[model samples]
Target: MDILSTVELNDCPLCLGPGLLEEEGGHCVYATCLDCGCHTVPVNYRTEAEKLDAAQRVAHLWNVGKVISEGVGE
Candidate 1:
């Protein structure tokens, strides 16, 4: 599997933790992380290409932290 599928396999890409609960939001699908006790929209990916794109973006965020861990970790 690619990175996007790999990432989604673990948990929510936003929080990057366990206990991710899926919530349908109109046109978008949302998943919440339970470990950090925070909510996130994660990367907005569509098709396989989109998923890959989003996965790459999310990987950057995961490494940089600033992209997602705002007010959560410093």
Candidate 2:
């Protein structure tokens, strides 16, 4: 999770709130909005070395408004 802190991200596109990088099961990374529950598609990684690139990919998706919001708010 420490490595994920290096990735920069934009504000949440759906709620304009703060966003952070999230790791799933120690194998994938994605960006998510803490306030609105919006998240980008997870990028899978096979090895520990690929985690950085995976984090960057998801960050890019999130920064460009490519996130998915399935909850009530838009």
lDDT of the candidates, in the order given: 0.46, 0.90
Top candidate by lDDT: 2
The TM-score between candidate 2 and the true structure equals 0.89
Worst 10 residues of 1 by lDDT: 21-30
Q: Per-residue CA lDDT of candidate 2, range 1-74, in tens?
A: 58888889999998899999988888888899999888999999988779999998999999899999988654
| Cα error, candidate 2, residue 46 (Å) | 1.7
Clashes of each: 0, 0
The weakest ten consecutive residues by lDDT in model 2 span 65-74
Model 1 — TM-score against the truth? 0.41
Clashes of 2: 0
